[model samples]
Target: MTMSEGDLAVTELAFVRREQIAPLPPPAMTTGPLAWVRDNLLSSILNVILTVVMTALAVWVIYEILDFLIFTAVWSGADREACLASPAQPVVGACWPFVKERAAYFVYGSYPIPERWRVDIFFAMLATGIVWLLWLNAPRRDIGAFYFFVIVPIVSYILLTGWPLIGLEAVDTALWGGVLVTIVVAWAGIVVSLPVGIVLALGRRSRMTTVRTLSVIFIEFVRGVPLITVLFMASVMLPLFVPDQWSPDKLLRALVGIALFASAYMAEVVRAGLAAIPKGQFEGAQAVGLGYWQMMRFIVLPQALKITIPNIVNTYIGLFKDTTLVFIVGIFDLLKTVEVSRIDPKWATPVTSTTGYAVAAIFYFVFCYGMSCYARATEARLARSERR
Candidate 1:
């Protein structure tokens, strides 16, 4: 029964070791969503406070949006008289009825009611072509080449100009108004500006001093001037430059101005892409015995353009929105359509401001959103191929 000091010492050491080796407190409970959240949002008092503030702000925004859109609209709609109460006492929610009434005009402009099917067919073909282009795994270059080089121009011109080889009546350009005009201007600008931009960018970097100097002067000069001034020049000064008997259509003049302005901007964007390319790319081209044009077409430009597609798309989006400024030159684009709508005596209620603004906002949102989505898809496709 009696134990030695040695025995007691051994027993005490054994107990200490057991305590130290007790599974290490279950490894501190790592590797779960809760742990991740705690690490990210609740790790410190400051983080917790930030999280709470953001959540509250988000909830408040959602509640306000719901109340304004759903609740207010429901209240106003329950009493039809309340919606049309007065220009001063108009419903606080959206005037969707105004949109419903004039949406066709917004879509097709002043294109004849009887021949609206032409616009429909044109849009359908364009949509199909776009869908094919956006399918990254598809035979893009071939399909897109057809869409770009052949189909698009023919379909768009026929629908817009209505030169009517197919029993459809001709629609005068003068009568065109609304979102169609916006699209017409943007599309024309995009197509015309791209080739012009490519040339200008190449010229700016060309070995020929004359070409380089001229490109620099033109790009900088156009970019330096405001779009409004360009539109003004297209409308006013362009006539003076032309033969006295040769007056171009107003829409054509606006298109030329928009294309020129957009091309200048596009050239700068392309030039930035060109400059970002490594000198070694050019050297590699030469090492391959490729000539200047071949080197640019095959090696340098492909890589440079891949890097700049996102930037190019952004520039296009800006150009698309800027098409609205053609209104300054008396061209009726989407925004101008809204401006014109307000002058209608029947629709010219005190509510015209809200209605017109709401329509324009939606039109812009649709187009700009589409362009942004296209840019994202293009970026994703490029990323998958290990290109920026």
Candidate 2:
């Protein structure tokens, strides 16, 4: 169609100029570190005030901690005298020398110095197994699980307590104290509670009336009582019910008590996870003609456990810390060993108790923090796999 003269003039006037149509960069207010700072820390006046206040408080805390832990700390000393300042001087810091000297007692307890290599070897094996299990893309995980679940426990028991048939001197359970006892109790509780808890959780969901009732009763009863009561019952009252000829070791009693207590709590965590699973999952498994156990094994539990990883780890951390309560039943754990060391006249300085506690706190923090990190990593991995 031919255009009128007026329309043609208007079209020519509306034509774009190429030089005036260049690409433009993002706004300065929406890019780079400065932009991020503005959007986050300085987004509002209140945020800016909070950020500055928090930063200053953090700096002050860090400086104070570093000053106390490092600046005036005594690195090497012979005894209480070395840790103390002369009348002419004032001192305030950790007596690290006592920690250094008593390190073996804290780690091995009364474990014989000659047999300490066994503990070292067991720890090495534990580290290897944990690394293998937790490492992403690791090989032969099945073999690693077998070694961890079966061979390691058996071999570790023999090594730690010795084997007469193998011509090794036996170490009494009474001599087991400090971190050695703590680890043993905590690990046993963790390993035993998981399977037991799973069973209880399954039982709680069972169609059988008796099974569900019993599971409820047990879970409620155990969960209702304090852990200290459980420990006392296991240590004191449990012996009365058994035959006089059959005596259980103190460590065994503590382990059983801890395992049972932990299992009760763990069962609830597992049950919550199970409840979160959609009914469609169970129905889907049933649609394929899968039996009850088969459906749970293949579909329900895997999903449930993945969902409950955080809660499971939390329970485990609590159980690990609870191992310290064994001290009430006359079993010396890490904290108990520290307390015992503090009473020793040789190392009795004003700072001895605080320093010992600090050491114990560091040990506990390292282990608990590792577990937390593993939980986070596992959760991230599972989330990625689900996205895929």
Candidate 3:
């Protein structure tokens, strides 16, 4: 098998094994991150144009926003005296000092000045519980559940609306306003509506004709009417529905209306998720001999609810914002608080529009944006898990 000197060897066979240096290949660009940007972001002529336009638009928007918030209004240079100056000679900028002066009102509303510490404690507990829940991989999972379902609610409720057992003075819901009212209404709506929504969704999917019909009628009836009308009915008609001897609190009445309205929308959202699930999943549950509740609790709902998380989050955001509509029912929420502040004789001026609106905008942005971010993160995590 020796190849004497017979073959000069084909192509570069000899050199292949030799330590001979070959010419380096010409450098070629790769479609890595940079190339990805060039393609998707700047691929076609139209895309390139769009990119340029968007970049310009973004820069222009930033410039204008900064100019308004910083330079033109002299927000950075405004002193305390300048800020608290009469509304007549307004700075035309954000009345941040006004917000600062009434920050307590914004947070706890007219809750007793001495009891504001309770608000602080409630917030601290809420924040801690939320953080604990987020750290689900911790060994304190069971503890976390207890804190969430039991401790947190009890603590928050007691702190917000005191208790005779704790020797604390009770604060009436009627005195609640500002962000406290917002939080109360939003949280109550979320808690109450979710279970109701689940029931309604189940009813809509039930085999029983009467239950299904009832669900459909309820959903359609609520969905067809505007929230304004629902609020009106709650304010005017809810009392009549109950016995005169058992009059519901105005806040409770509004809560019922909100819960009912929110549940109808949430039911639709959940129904969409339920519909997306395959029929085989149900049959599989049946084949396994899982009872209806067990099948739904373990098998069907987990998957359906996961699919519906985005929709459900959207519904939640809608409900949170819609709680503002309780103002129409004479229930003071965050928006209503601002509305009240705008009418203050001292603060009522041309700038009142700007100040009240700016404050409300900031609050709304915080809640809505936080919800959106949470949904995005949840969606991303679910996507990654699916991949794995």
lDDT of every predicted structure (CA atoms): 0.79, 0.91, 0.79
Q: Taking the tens digit of each residue's C-alpha lDDT, what string does model 1 give over 1-388? A: 9899999899778843345545554444475777788899899999999999999999999887565445544232322333455667454555455556667877777778887777777667766776676666777568686886588878778776776568657888877878778877887888788779989999999999999999999999999999999999989898989896797889989998999999999898888889999999999889989999999899988887888898898888889888888888887777877777667655544555566776687678887898899888777877887853
Which parts of model 3 are misplaced by more than 4 Å?
A: 1-37, 73-92, 241-245
Q: Rank the candidates by lDDT, best first.
A: 2, 3, 1
Q: How accurate locally is residue 123 in candidate 2, as Cα lDDT from 0 to 100?
A: 88
Give the better candidate number (1 or 3) by TM-score. Answer: 3
**Which has the better TM-score: candidate 2, or candidate 3?**
2
Off by over 4 Å in 1: 1-70, 74-82, 85-91, 164-166, 243-245, 343-345, 348-352
Could you tell me the lDDT of residue 309 within candidate 3?
Answer: 91
| Highest TM-score model number | 2
User: Higher lDDT: candidate 2 or 3?
Assistant: 2
Off by over 4 Å in 2: 1-49, 87-89
Evaluated against the true structure, the overall lDDT of model 2 is 0.91
Question: What would the TM-scores of all predictions be?
Answer: 0.81, 0.90, 0.84
lDDT of 2 by residue, 1-388 (tens): 9999999899888966668666898998899988999999999999999999999999999887676578877888788887887774376678888999999999999999999999999889988988888786799999998988898899999999899998879999899889899999998999889989999999999999999999999999999999999999999998999986786987898899999999999999999999999999999999999999899899999999999999999999999888889999999899999999999899888888988998988899999999999899889988898899
